[model samples]
Target: MTDASSSLSSLIWADWPAPDHVKACVSTRIGGFSPAPYDSFNMGDHVGDSPANVVKNRARFLHLCRLKRVGQWLTQVHGTQVVEAKDDGKVREGDAVYSHEANLPCVVMTADCLPVLFTDEQGSVVAAAHAGWRGLASGVLEKTVATMGVAPSSVLAWMGPAIGRHQFEVGGEVRREFVEHHPATDQAFQPDYQSRGKYYADLYELARIRLGLIGVHQVFGGGFCTWKDERFYSFRREGTTGRMASMIWIKK
Candidate 1:
């Protein structure tokens, strides 16, 4: 496998100790052809960016990553469904995707929501998940772990950029959803002093709790706050903005 550092100066590589065959990286809003608002490397076609520009940006991403296969992009509905990544070039409707096959990149687009990548220690499989508050509460990570067909203890996860705890304000419903499922998640939410019926949530902590529940203790990356970081796209920061992608694959 090629050294990721050579091709990925503008992106964030997952900092886990994944095997050499397991490749993963998260795209930034830099180095592409799109114009303002979506300004440059916008990877999500479903967003309002020009289709031609989106295509070009995707091409640039593939070339920069030195990936020979097409990314399996999903039509994420913020649900817990996890599907196997296939190279059919068709967009599947799900929040997470896993693949044991080499060269098929499992990818998820996100702006403010969390993008998570997963791999087993043996480098035999990789998966990606889009975890918004709804998806997180609905068990997306748990579903992804189960889909990988590996023991939870063997899985390593990396959390990508997202709206951070101090910036991500949530309603009572959001807090209730998590607390009802796992009371320990209550600590992940802090009361929003400015808003009465709202709280600031720690998405990274929530993800760690979920992964820990399934015995996945090796987690990394999560210091990113898309809203504050200009390098990443953020929906909450820009209402009509583009999306960045978190992708993973096994080198063929």
Candidate 2:
């Protein structure tokens, strides 16, 4: 039995460049009721954690955030599918979700994969995206930014913790997907010696490139590495693991 009230002290929330009207946060794996790999703050339901503990953990975390309804969804096999948060509880398969309506908290879960949050200058809209390599390459950020119905120039983004470049070993095919998207992706890939057909890839840089292409230059955050930081949940670091959430919303 974990204490939900006292557990709020352990999650990590990003302090991005967005204005006060937009409320955004990313949870770490420190505050919840589970044991071992899913010890605490594991918000993912399909990751093999006990369903009851996952439920308790999510309820406890949601309560701690003081939110009644949070929009979370079924993330499909890495691709860029952006949907509306109004589709919450419907189990839509998508990599991103956004809403112009107030009080609809959009969220994405992650371990080593990147969770990116977005909002505009007016703070009338907010979005969250699950950007694993394929999603990033397939334009997940671009898709999310387009859902805002605002000028892309007015958008701001915050890249949450993810697998760092040094630890993200990718095969030639993975690198091909990015380079095929943009030849400039070469800059974000480096040779990996541990295997003959692998390279170190930087997810943040790849996202920045895609975001910049869509005119989102006011981006912030993106310096943390889930695989390297003990405070975060890293699927790559630990084979069977927990997931943390990155969320964003407009206070209604």
The lDDT per prediction is 0.90, 0.83
Pairing residues by index, what is the TM-score of model 2?
0.93
Question: Can you give the lDDT of residue 14 in candidate 2?
Answer: 67
Model 2 per-residue lDDT tens digits across residues 124-183: 888899999978888888888887789999998998999999999999999998898698
TM-score of each model, paired residue for residue: 0.96, 0.93
- The parts of candidate 2 lying over 4 Å away from their true place are 1-7
Error of 1 at 228 (Å): 0.5
The global Cα lDDT (0 to 1) of model 1 is 0.90
Count steric clashes of candidate 1: 0
Per-residue lDDT of candidate 1, residues 1-252 (tens digit):
123323577788888899998989988888777888888888889888899998887877888778877878889899999988877788889999999998889999999999999999999889999999999998999999998999999999999999999999999999999999799999999998888999999999999998998899999999999999998898898899989989999997
* Per-model root-mean-square deviation over C-alphas: 3.1, 1.8
Distance from true location, Cα of 159 in model 2, Å: 0.6
lDDT, candidate 2, equals: 0.83
How well does candidate 1 match the true structure in TM-score terms? 0.96
